[model samples]
Target: MNRRKQKKLTNRLVWAAAVGDTCTVRTVLRTGVDPELPEADGTTALYAASVHGAASTVRALLRAGALPNTESRGITDGTPLCGAAAWGHVATVRELLTHGADPNLREDGGAGSTPLFWARNGASGPHPETEAALVAAGATD
Candidate 1:
Protein backbone atom coordinates (compact mmCIF):
# COMPACT_ATOMS: atom_id res chain seq x y z
CA MET A 1 0.00 0.00 0.00
CA ASN A 2 1.05 3.55 -0.54
CA ARG A 3 1.81 5.94 2.30
CA ARG A 4 -1.58 7.63 2.06
CA LYS A 5 -3.51 4.37 2.07
CA GLN A 6 -1.50 3.05 4.99
CA LYS A 7 -2.16 6.22 6.92
CA LYS A 8 -5.86 6.00 6.18
CA LEU A 9 -5.97 2.42 7.46
CA THR A 10 -4.15 3.42 10.61
CA ASN A 11 -6.58 6.26 11.26
CA ARG A 12 -9.49 3.90 10.74
CA LEU A 13 -8.09 1.46 13.27
CA VAL A 14 -7.63 4.23 15.80
CA TRP A 15 -11.16 5.45 15.21
CA ALA A 16 -12.52 1.93 15.56
CA ALA A 17 -10.88 1.50 18.93
CA ALA A 18 -12.00 4.93 20.08
CA VAL A 19 -15.58 4.06 19.21
CA GLY A 20 -15.34 0.71 21.06
CA ASP A 21 -15.67 -1.41 17.95
CA THR A 22 -13.35 -4.17 19.05
CA CYS A 23 -14.43 -6.56 16.31
CA THR A 24 -13.58 -4.09 13.59
CA VAL A 25 -10.29 -3.33 15.29
CA ARG A 26 -9.38 -6.99 15.47
CA THR A 27 -10.37 -7.53 11.86
CA VAL A 28 -8.15 -4.65 10.77
CA LEU A 29 -5.25 -5.95 12.80
CA ARG A 30 -5.67 -9.41 11.33
CA THR A 31 -5.42 -7.84 7.89
CA GLY A 32 -1.78 -6.95 8.55
CA VAL A 33 -2.47 -3.40 9.72
CA ASP A 34 0.07 -1.68 11.90
CA PRO A 35 -1.29 -1.18 15.40
CA GLU A 36 1.22 1.48 16.34
CA LEU A 37 0.35 3.74 13.43
CA PRO A 38 -0.73 7.20 14.58
CA GLU A 39 -3.49 9.40 13.30
CA ALA A 40 -2.99 12.82 11.79
CA ASP A 41 -3.19 14.17 15.28
CA GLY A 42 -0.53 11.73 16.42
CA THR A 43 -3.06 9.67 18.33
CA THR A 44 -2.43 5.94 18.16
CA ALA A 45 -4.94 3.11 18.45
CA LEU A 46 -3.82 2.54 22.02
CA TYR A 47 -4.29 6.21 22.80
CA ALA A 48 -7.78 6.25 21.33
CA ALA A 49 -8.71 3.09 23.20
CA SER A 50 -7.35 4.55 26.41
CA VAL A 51 -9.36 7.73 26.06
CA HIS A 52 -12.48 5.79 25.20
CA GLY A 53 -12.12 3.36 28.13
CA ALA A 54 -11.80 0.36 25.86
CA ALA A 55 -9.76 -1.94 28.05
CA SER A 56 -9.98 -4.92 25.71
CA THR A 57 -8.90 -2.88 22.75
CA VAL A 58 -6.08 -1.35 24.71
CA ARG A 59 -4.91 -4.79 25.79
CA ALA A 60 -5.04 -6.10 22.27
CA LEU A 61 -3.03 -3.16 20.97
CA LEU A 62 -0.49 -3.63 23.74
CA ARG A 63 -0.20 -7.29 22.86
CA ALA A 64 0.47 -6.14 19.31
CA GLY A 65 3.36 -4.01 20.56
CA ALA A 66 1.74 -0.56 20.69
CA LEU A 67 3.73 1.95 22.70
CA PRO A 68 1.98 3.14 25.82
CA ASN A 69 3.94 6.37 25.84
CA THR A 70 3.11 7.30 22.28
CA GLU A 71 2.58 11.06 21.96
CA SER A 72 -0.56 12.74 20.66
CA ARG A 73 -1.22 15.56 18.24
CA GLY A 74 -1.10 19.32 18.57
CA ILE A 75 0.63 21.29 21.28
CA THR A 76 -0.67 19.10 24.08
CA ASP A 77 2.15 16.61 23.53
CA GLY A 78 0.25 14.12 25.62
CA THR A 79 0.66 10.36 25.95
CA PRO A 80 -1.87 7.51 26.08
CA LEU A 81 -1.44 7.49 29.84
CA CYS A 82 -2.48 11.13 29.95
CA GLY A 83 -5.50 10.44 27.75
CA ALA A 84 -6.60 7.56 29.97
CA ALA A 85 -6.17 9.62 33.10
CA ALA A 86 -7.85 12.69 31.66
CA TRP A 87 -10.84 10.66 30.53
CA GLY A 88 -11.14 8.84 33.87
CA HIS A 89 -10.68 5.45 32.27
CA VAL A 90 -9.51 3.47 35.26
CA ALA A 91 -9.42 0.06 33.64
CA THR A 92 -7.66 1.47 30.64
CA VAL A 93 -5.15 3.21 32.85
CA ARG A 94 -4.50 0.01 34.73
CA GLU A 95 -4.03 -1.89 31.51
CA LEU A 96 -1.62 0.69 30.16
CA LEU A 97 0.36 0.73 33.36
CA THR A 98 0.52 -3.03 33.45
CA HIS A 99 1.92 -2.90 29.96
CA GLY A 100 4.75 -0.63 31.17
CA ALA A 101 3.28 2.87 30.84
CA ASP A 102 5.15 5.37 32.97
CA PRO A 103 2.82 7.31 35.22
CA ASN A 104 5.49 9.94 35.67
CA LEU A 105 6.05 10.51 31.99
CA ARG A 106 5.33 14.16 31.30
CA GLU A 107 4.69 15.98 28.07
CA ASP A 108 7.35 18.02 26.39
CA GLY A 109 7.58 21.81 26.77
CA GLY A 110 6.42 23.23 30.11
CA ALA A 111 3.52 20.86 30.77
CA GLY A 112 5.96 18.88 32.92
CA SER A 113 2.95 17.25 34.53
CA THR A 114 2.71 13.50 35.10
CA PRO A 115 -0.17 11.11 34.49
CA LEU A 116 -1.02 11.38 38.18
CA PHE A 117 -1.39 15.11 37.85
CA TRP A 118 -3.76 14.69 34.95
CA ALA A 119 -5.80 12.10 36.84
CA ARG A 120 -5.99 14.29 39.91
CA ASN A 121 -6.62 17.56 38.15
CA GLY A 122 -8.69 16.57 35.15
CA ALA A 123 -11.10 14.03 36.61
CA SER A 124 -14.62 15.32 37.35
CA GLY A 125 -16.93 12.32 37.53
CA PRO A 126 -18.38 10.71 40.65
CA HIS A 127 -16.10 7.69 40.85
CA PRO A 128 -12.61 9.16 40.51
CA GLU A 129 -11.60 5.72 39.39
CA THR A 130 -8.96 7.10 37.11
CA GLU A 131 -7.16 8.73 40.00
CA ALA A 132 -7.45 5.50 41.94
CA ALA A 133 -6.03 3.61 39.04
CA LEU A 134 -3.15 6.03 38.73
CA VAL A 135 -2.43 5.60 42.42
CA ALA A 136 -2.48 1.85 42.01
CA ALA A 137 -0.04 2.26 39.15
CA GLY A 138 2.36 4.00 41.56
CA ALA A 139 1.38 7.64 40.95
CA THR A 140 2.70 9.79 43.80
CA ASP A 141 0.52 12.89 43.49
Candidate 2:
Protein backbone atom coordinates (compact mmCIF):
# COMPACT_ATOMS: atom_id res chain seq x y z
CA MET A 1 0.00 0.00 0.00
CA ASN A 2 1.62 3.19 -1.14
CA ARG A 3 1.03 6.38 0.88
CA ARG A 4 -1.29 7.79 -1.76
CA LYS A 5 -3.32 4.59 -1.99
CA GLN A 6 -3.55 4.34 1.77
CA LYS A 7 -4.72 7.95 2.00
CA LYS A 8 -7.36 7.36 -0.64
CA LEU A 9 -8.64 4.26 1.14
CA THR A 10 -8.71 6.10 4.42
CA ASN A 11 -10.69 8.95 2.86
CA ARG A 12 -13.16 6.46 1.47
CA LEU A 13 -13.52 4.77 4.82
CA VAL A 14 -14.04 8.06 6.61
CA TRP A 15 -16.62 9.26 4.09
CA ALA A 16 -18.40 5.91 4.16
CA ALA A 17 -18.57 5.87 7.92
CA ALA A 18 -19.78 9.49 8.05
CA VAL A 19 -22.62 8.65 5.71
CA GLY A 20 -23.54 5.42 7.52
CA ASP A 21 -22.40 3.32 4.59
CA THR A 22 -21.68 0.21 6.58
CA CYS A 23 -21.05 -1.96 3.53
CA THR A 24 -18.42 0.40 2.21
CA VAL A 25 -16.88 0.61 5.63
CA ARG A 26 -16.56 -3.17 5.78
CA THR A 27 -15.17 -3.32 2.26
CA VAL A 28 -12.55 -0.72 3.05
CA LEU A 29 -11.66 -2.51 6.26
CA ARG A 30 -11.14 -5.72 4.27
CA THR A 31 -8.68 -3.79 2.09
CA GLY A 32 -6.48 -3.41 5.18
CA VAL A 33 -6.88 0.35 5.72
CA ASP A 34 -6.14 1.17 9.30
CA PRO A 35 -9.44 1.56 11.11
CA GLU A 36 -7.81 4.20 13.27
CA LEU A 37 -6.69 6.34 10.36
CA PRO A 38 -7.69 9.98 10.78
CA GLU A 39 -8.51 12.58 8.20
CA ALA A 40 -6.42 15.70 7.56
CA ASP A 41 -7.80 17.36 10.66
CA GLY A 42 -7.57 14.23 12.79
CA THR A 43 -11.06 12.78 12.62
CA THR A 44 -11.00 9.00 12.74
CA ALA A 45 -13.49 6.86 10.84
CA LEU A 46 -15.01 5.67 14.12
CA TYR A 47 -15.38 9.27 15.32
CA ALA A 48 -17.03 10.32 12.08
CA ALA A 49 -19.43 7.37 12.27
CA SER A 50 -20.21 7.98 15.91
CA VAL A 51 -20.95 11.69 15.40
CA HIS A 52 -23.49 10.86 12.72
CA GLY A 53 -25.21 8.37 15.02
CA ALA A 54 -24.40 5.67 12.51
CA ALA A 55 -24.57 2.74 14.87
CA SER A 56 -24.14 0.09 12.21
CA THR A 57 -21.16 1.86 10.72
CA VAL A 58 -19.82 2.34 14.23
CA ARG A 59 -20.13 -1.40 14.80
CA ALA A 60 -18.34 -2.18 11.55
CA LEU A 61 -15.47 0.13 12.42
CA LEU A 62 -15.24 -1.23 15.95
CA ARG A 63 -15.26 -4.80 14.68
CA ALA A 64 -12.46 -3.78 12.33
CA GLY A 65 -10.40 -2.55 15.32
CA ALA A 66 -11.32 1.16 15.56
CA LEU A 67 -10.55 2.53 18.98
CA PRO A 68 -13.74 3.79 20.58
CA ASN A 69 -11.98 6.42 22.67
CA THR A 70 -9.92 8.01 19.92
CA GLU A 71 -10.42 11.79 19.76
CA SER A 72 -11.12 14.02 16.80
CA ARG A 73 -9.55 17.41 16.32
CA GLY A 74 -10.38 20.65 14.42
CA ILE A 75 -13.96 20.57 13.18
CA THR A 76 -15.23 17.64 15.24
CA ASP A 77 -13.29 17.95 18.43
CA GLY A 78 -13.88 15.17 20.92
CA THR A 79 -13.67 11.49 21.58
CA PRO A 80 -16.12 9.31 19.66
CA LEU A 81 -18.17 8.89 22.84
CA CYS A 82 -18.18 12.64 23.41
CA GLY A 83 -19.28 13.31 19.85
CA ALA A 84 -22.09 10.76 20.12
CA ALA A 85 -23.21 12.01 23.51
CA ALA A 86 -23.09 15.66 22.41
CA TRP A 87 -25.40 14.79 19.60
CA GLY A 88 -27.70 12.90 21.99
CA HIS A 89 -27.20 9.62 20.19
CA VAL A 90 -27.88 6.99 22.81
CA ALA A 91 -27.33 3.99 20.57
CA THR A 92 -24.02 5.36 19.33
CA VAL A 93 -22.99 6.11 22.89
CA ARG A 94 -23.85 2.57 23.97
CA GLU A 95 -22.01 1.11 21.04
CA LEU A 96 -18.95 3.13 21.95
CA LEU A 97 -19.16 2.20 25.63
CA THR A 98 -19.64 -1.47 24.84
CA HIS A 99 -16.54 -1.31 22.68
CA GLY A 100 -14.37 0.09 25.52
CA ALA A 101 -14.88 3.87 25.21
CA ASP A 102 -13.97 5.44 28.50
CA PRO A 103 -17.10 7.20 29.66
CA ASN A 104 -14.98 9.60 31.67
CA LEU A 105 -12.82 10.66 28.76
CA ARG A 106 -12.74 14.46 28.27
CA GLU A 107 -12.83 16.48 25.06
CA ASP A 108 -9.72 18.58 24.92
CA GLY A 109 -11.10 20.84 22.21
CA GLY A 110 -13.84 22.09 24.47
CA ALA A 111 -13.85 22.82 28.17
CA GLY A 112 -12.67 19.27 28.63
CA SER A 113 -16.27 18.17 28.96
CA THR A 114 -17.05 14.52 29.55
CA PRO A 115 -19.71 12.50 27.81
CA LEU A 116 -22.04 13.08 30.74
CA PHE A 117 -21.74 16.84 30.38
CA TRP A 118 -22.52 16.67 26.71
CA ALA A 119 -25.54 14.45 27.31
CA ARG A 120 -26.93 16.83 29.91
CA ASN A 121 -26.23 19.96 27.93
CA GLY A 122 -26.65 18.56 24.49
CA ALA A 123 -27.94 20.91 21.80
CA SER A 124 -30.60 18.34 20.99
CA GLY A 125 -31.88 19.02 24.51
CA PRO A 126 -31.16 17.02 27.61
CA HIS A 127 -31.21 13.41 26.57
CA PRO A 128 -32.24 11.34 29.55
CA GLU A 129 -31.59 8.10 27.75
CA THR A 130 -28.15 9.24 26.70
CA GLU A 131 -27.46 10.43 30.24
CA ALA A 132 -28.61 7.13 31.68
CA ALA A 133 -26.44 5.15 29.30
CA LEU A 134 -23.40 7.25 30.16
CA VAL A 135 -24.08 6.90 33.86
CA ALA A 136 -24.49 3.17 33.50
CA ALA A 137 -21.13 3.14 31.79
CA GLY A 138 -19.64 4.87 34.86
CA ALA A 139 -19.37 8.36 33.39
CA THR A 140 -19.17 11.09 35.99
CA ASP A 141 -19.49 14.87 35.97
Candidate 3:
Protein backbone atom coordinates (compact mmCIF):
# COMPACT_ATOMS: atom_id res chain seq x y z
CA MET A 1 0.00 0.00 0.00
CA ASN A 2 1.19 3.54 -0.65
CA ARG A 3 2.12 5.75 2.31
CA ARG A 4 -0.88 7.96 1.64
CA LYS A 5 -3.33 5.06 1.60
CA GLN A 6 -1.72 3.47 4.64
CA LYS A 7 -1.97 6.73 6.57
CA LYS A 8 -5.62 7.10 5.67
CA LEU A 9 -6.40 3.57 6.80
CA THR A 10 -4.51 4.15 10.01
CA ASN A 11 -6.53 7.25 10.74
CA ARG A 12 -9.72 5.38 9.98
CA LEU A 13 -8.65 2.56 12.28
CA VAL A 14 -7.99 4.97 15.12
CA TRP A 15 -11.28 6.78 14.63
CA ALA A 16 -13.24 3.56 14.34
CA ALA A 17 -11.61 2.21 17.47
CA ALA A 18 -12.32 5.37 19.38
CA VAL A 19 -15.99 5.33 18.42
CA GLY A 20 -16.46 1.58 19.03
CA ASP A 21 -17.14 1.00 15.36
CA THR A 22 -16.01 -2.61 15.27
CA CYS A 23 -17.16 -3.13 11.69
CA THR A 24 -14.99 -0.34 10.35
CA VAL A 25 -12.17 -1.41 12.58
CA ARG A 26 -12.27 -4.94 11.18
CA THR A 27 -12.32 -3.67 7.65
CA VAL A 28 -9.25 -1.53 8.27
CA LEU A 29 -7.47 -4.44 9.86
CA ARG A 30 -8.19 -6.58 6.79
CA THR A 31 -6.39 -4.04 4.64
CA GLY A 32 -3.17 -5.25 6.30
CA VAL A 33 -2.77 -2.11 8.37
CA ASP A 34 -1.08 -3.03 11.60
CA PRO A 35 -3.54 -2.58 14.41
CA GLU A 36 -0.73 -1.22 16.56
CA LEU A 37 -0.25 1.79 14.30
CA PRO A 38 -0.29 4.91 16.42
CA GLU A 39 -1.76 8.29 15.67
CA ALA A 40 0.52 11.35 15.51
CA ASP A 41 0.86 11.46 19.26
CA GLY A 42 1.25 7.75 19.87
CA THR A 43 -2.22 6.41 20.57
CA THR A 44 -2.77 2.96 19.13
CA ALA A 45 -6.13 1.56 18.02
CA LEU A 46 -6.31 -0.63 21.11
CA TYR A 47 -5.56 2.33 23.38
CA ALA A 48 -8.21 4.44 21.69
CA ALA A 49 -10.79 1.66 21.86
CA SER A 50 -10.02 0.89 25.49
CA VAL A 51 -10.23 4.52 26.58
CA HIS A 52 -13.65 4.79 25.00
CA GLY A 53 -14.82 1.50 26.54
CA ALA A 54 -15.12 -0.02 23.11
CA ALA A 55 -14.81 -3.66 24.12
CA SER A 56 -15.68 -5.13 20.72
CA THR A 57 -13.26 -2.82 18.95
CA VAL A 58 -10.65 -3.64 21.54
CA ARG A 59 -11.14 -7.31 20.81
CA ALA A 60 -10.76 -6.77 17.09
CA LEU A 61 -7.55 -4.82 17.55
CA LEU A 62 -6.16 -7.35 19.95
CA ARG A 63 -7.02 -10.19 17.61
CA ALA A 64 -4.97 -8.31 15.04
CA GLY A 65 -2.03 -8.38 17.49
CA ALA A 66 -2.34 -5.01 19.23
CA LEU A 67 -0.25 -5.12 22.37
CA PRO A 68 -2.43 -4.99 25.44
CA ASN A 69 0.19 -3.24 27.55
CA THR A 70 1.71 -0.61 25.28
CA GLU A 71 2.09 2.80 26.91
CA SER A 72 0.48 5.56 24.85
CA ARG A 73 0.41 9.34 24.77
CA GLY A 74 -1.90 11.90 23.12
CA ILE A 75 -5.66 12.17 23.64
CA THR A 76 -5.11 9.75 26.53
CA ASP A 77 -1.89 8.94 28.37
CA GLY A 78 -1.42 5.45 29.70
CA THR A 79 -1.70 1.77 29.02
CA PRO A 80 -4.95 0.51 27.54
CA LEU A 81 -5.71 -1.27 30.82
CA CYS A 82 -5.27 1.96 32.78
CA GLY A 83 -7.58 3.82 30.40
CA ALA A 84 -10.32 1.18 30.72
CA ALA A 85 -10.00 0.96 34.49
CA ALA A 86 -9.96 4.73 34.97
CA TRP A 87 -13.19 4.98 33.02
CA GLY A 88 -14.76 2.14 34.98
CA HIS A 89 -15.46 0.17 31.88
CA VAL A 90 -15.91 -3.24 33.42
CA ALA A 91 -16.37 -5.20 30.20
CA THR A 92 -13.50 -3.36 28.56
CA VAL A 93 -11.28 -4.02 31.53
CA ARG A 94 -12.24 -7.68 31.48
CA GLU A 95 -11.55 -7.93 27.76
CA LEU A 96 -8.08 -6.39 28.17
CA LEU A 97 -7.27 -8.60 31.14
CA THR A 98 -8.47 -11.67 29.31
CA HIS A 99 -6.20 -10.73 26.44
CA GLY A 100 -3.13 -10.53 28.71
CA ALA A 101 -3.13 -6.92 29.88
CA ASP A 102 -0.85 -6.77 32.88
CA PRO A 103 -3.06 -5.81 35.75
CA ASN A 104 0.02 -4.35 37.40
CA LEU A 105 1.36 -2.25 34.56
CA ARG A 106 1.78 1.39 35.61
CA GLU A 107 1.12 4.49 33.60
CA ASP A 108 4.38 5.93 32.27
CA GLY A 109 3.60 9.56 32.98
CA GLY A 110 1.32 10.61 35.83
CA ALA A 111 1.97 9.16 39.28
CA GLY A 112 2.65 5.69 37.99
CA SER A 113 -0.97 4.75 38.48
CA THR A 114 -1.81 1.11 37.98
CA PRO A 115 -5.11 -0.19 36.74
CA LEU A 116 -6.28 -0.94 40.29
CA PHE A 117 -5.29 2.52 41.46
CA TRP A 118 -7.11 4.15 38.60
CA ALA A 119 -10.19 2.06 39.27
CA ARG A 120 -10.25 3.00 42.95
CA ASN A 121 -9.49 6.65 42.41
CA GLY A 122 -11.14 7.41 39.11
CA ALA A 123 -12.21 11.02 38.72
CA SER A 124 -15.70 9.84 37.84
CA GLY A 125 -15.77 8.02 41.21
CA PRO A 126 -14.60 4.76 42.66
CA HIS A 127 -15.33 1.85 40.37
CA PRO A 128 -15.83 -1.23 42.45
CA GLU A 129 -16.58 -3.43 39.47
CA THR A 130 -13.50 -2.19 37.71
CA GLU A 131 -11.42 -2.61 40.83
CA ALA A 132 -12.77 -6.09 41.36
CA ALA A 133 -11.91 -7.04 37.81
CA LEU A 134 -8.34 -5.79 38.26
CA VAL A 135 -7.96 -7.64 41.54
CA ALA A 136 -9.29 -10.80 39.98
CA ALA A 137 -6.67 -10.36 37.31
CA GLY A 138 -3.92 -10.17 40.01
CA ALA A 139 -3.58 -6.40 40.35
CA THR A 140 -2.22 -4.98 43.61
CA ASP A 141 -1.81 -1.52 45.20
Query: How large is the C-alpha RMSD of every model relative to the true structure?
Result: 2.2, 1.4, 1.4
lDDT of 1 by residue, 4-75 (tens): 888878988988998988888888888677897877877778878887889999988888888888776662
Q: Rank by TM-score, highest first.
A: 2, 3, 1
Looking at model 1, which ten-residue stretch has the lowest summed lDDT?
120-129
TM-score of 3: 0.94
Q: State the lDDT of candidate 2 residue by residue for 1-141, as single tens digits.
A: 899999999989999999999999999999999999898778899989988999999998998899887788877778899889888989999988888999998889545998999899986878899999999889887
Model 3: residues >4 Å from true position, as ranges? 109-111
TM agreement with the true structure for every prediction: 0.86, 0.95, 0.94
* lDDT value for model 1: 0.80
Any residue pairs clashing in model 2, and if so which? none
Clashing pairs in 3: none
Better of 1 and 2 by TM-score: 2
TM-score of 1: 0.86
29 Cα displacement, candidate 2 (Å): 0.7
Model 1 CA RMSD to the hidden true structure, in angstroms: 2.2
Query: 13-118 in candidate 3: lDDT tens per residue?
Result: 9999999999999998999998877877688889999989999999988999999988887756799999988889999999999999999989976458899988
Better of 1 and 3 by lDDT: 3
